[model samples]
Structures are given as structure tokens and as C-alpha cells.
Target: MELLFVFLGGAIFGTIARYTLPHRDEHGSVLVPAIGAVVASVVWVALTWLGWAWDGGWIWWVSLGASVIAVVVADLAIGRHRVQTDAALLTKLTGSTATATAH
Candidate 1:
């Protein structure tokens, strides 16, 4: 019951976090949602150890907000790698030809 709720909460948090972020061509997929789920699971475990119970009230709201922040921060930090990888791919695809013409 509680475990199920935690997972559901995580899914919701991940979805919202993914929606809130800018549409990066690299991250415009299910990765953010998956990351969110992992983040939620970690938070749930920590909270459980701290004796926090989710009764679906203010505590839940706080936990949700925290989880969202965690997801956003993690995405921002880890997403740089994805962006760099995408940039490298783009550069490779475009080749070394430098176009002087303005778009």
C-alpha cells in the first residue's frame, strides 16, 4: 500500500518535472520520468527510515515538492552529459563545414 503510493507519487513527480523542463532534443524522451521514479524511491526509503508516513496530506505535498526539486537538480546536473553528447553527434553529422550564410 505505502510502497505502491510511493511509486505512484514518484511517477507523478517525474512526469511533472519532465514537463516543466525545457524541451531539449536529447532529453525529450522517457529518461526524465525514469529518473524521477528513481529519485522518488530513494526519498521514500529515506523518509521511511526517518519514521515519516505518507497519509496524503501536507507531508505528502512536502515530500512531493522535495522530490520534484531533487529531480530537477539531478536532471540539470546530469543532463549536461547528454547535451554534450548530443552536441558532439550534431557536430559529427554536420561535419566540419562552416557555413557563413545566415539562417
Candidate 2:
């Protein structure tokens, strides 16, 4: 019963993470769910290590909520970094091409 609850919590967290990070690309959709699963596992482990007991039903809910939030936050931070890196790459590429063409 406890294992079932934990699995359900992880699934809900995964779904929430997917919904929070809306992606038009199918590739992103698949990746986000897997990322969410990892986030859920991390949260579960952390909570367990921190002496959090799962005797209460609310523990599952709390863990799931925290996991979802963590996933969303991580996705946003990483996405911003990726965008900046991509922009830099494009700028460098354009500059190199222009310089080459000038020669």
C-alpha cells in the first residue's frame, strides 16, 4: 500500500512538472517527463534521509508538491541558460561567417 502511494505521488509530480513546463516540441515533452521522474526520486530520497516519516497520508502529497516545484524551478533555470548559450553560439557563428566572406 505504501509503495503504491509513493508511485502515485511520483506520477502526479511527473505530470505536474510536464504541465508546468509547456513545450511545443515533442522531444521536449518526452524529456520533461523523464526529468520529472528523476526529480521525484531525488525528493523522495531527500525526505527519507531527512527523517521524514510516511505514516501520514499527507506526506505523499507534500513530497509530490515539493518534487513538482523543484522540477519546474530546475527546468526554468536550465532553459534560460540554454537560451543564452544558443544566442552566443549564433552570434559567434554569424561573426565568423561574415569575417570569412569578407576575405
Candidate 3:
């Protein structure tokens, strides 16, 4: 089905994003791709409900684009948050400023 293809496309894009982006070490390998597939699937279903034809070109574009956006944004946000949290934890445990040491 078209949905399956879209889901696979989203997952592929997500896999690409996961490897391409920095701070990938912060999360599991599956996380980014999973996010991508979910975003694409949700967008596709929503658009179909809102009257976009399933076979239309624009629908595919919008759905896939949304998946990429969601995947990238989530990856970046999670990476940054993890880094900050880790730094804070390090500072708390060692009683020294991790940020200061990095600079």
C-alpha cells in the first residue's frame, strides 16, 4: 500500500538523518528513524482525512517533509538536552564546572 511505502521512506530518511546529524551518540539507533516513520504516518493519515487524495503528489511531499522535519528537530533537541543534562550531572557529582572545563 501507499502508506507502507511512505512509512518506509520516512524510516529511510530518518536513518539518514540519524547518521548525518551530530550528537547521534546520545540516543539509540532506532530512535530517529522511528520518529520519522511515526511523523510521516501521522501526517499522511491526517492529510487523507482532510481531503487530500491518497495518490496525489503533494500529499507525499507534505507527509515526507513533515517526517524529516520532525525527525531532525527531535534529534537536535534530544541531543542538546542530553548533553546539558549530562554536563549538569557531571558538575553535580564532581563539584566542578563541566562547561568551564570544556571551554
The residue pairs that clash in candidate 1, if any, are none
Residue-by-residue lDDT tens digits, candidate 3, 21-102 = 9999999999999999999999999999999999889999999999999999999999999999998888887778755576
Q: Write the per-residue lDDT of candidate 2 for residues 1-103, one digit (tens) a residue.
A: 5545555666666666666564323236545555666666666667777887868655666767766776677667667777777767876987875775776
lDDT of each: 0.68, 0.63, 0.94
Stretches of model 1 off by over 4 angstroms after superposition: 54-59, 77-80, 92-103
Per-prediction TM-score: 0.65, 0.63, 0.92
lDDT of 3: 0.94
Candidate 3 regions with alpha-carbon error over 4 angstroms: 98-103
Ten consecutive residues with minimal summed lDDT in candidate 3?
A: 94-103
- The residue-by-residue lDDT of candidate 1 on 1-103, one tens digit each, is 7656766787777787777776434465667667666666677767777877666465566556667887788667667877777778876877633632222
Q: List where candidate 2 sits over 4 angstroms from the true fold.
A: 1-8, 19-27, 49-51, 96-103
Q: Which ten residues in a row have the lowest lDDT in candidate 1?
A: 94-103
Give the Cα error of residue 25 in candidate 1, in Å: 3.2
The full ranking of all candidates by lDDT, starting with the best, is 3, 1, 2
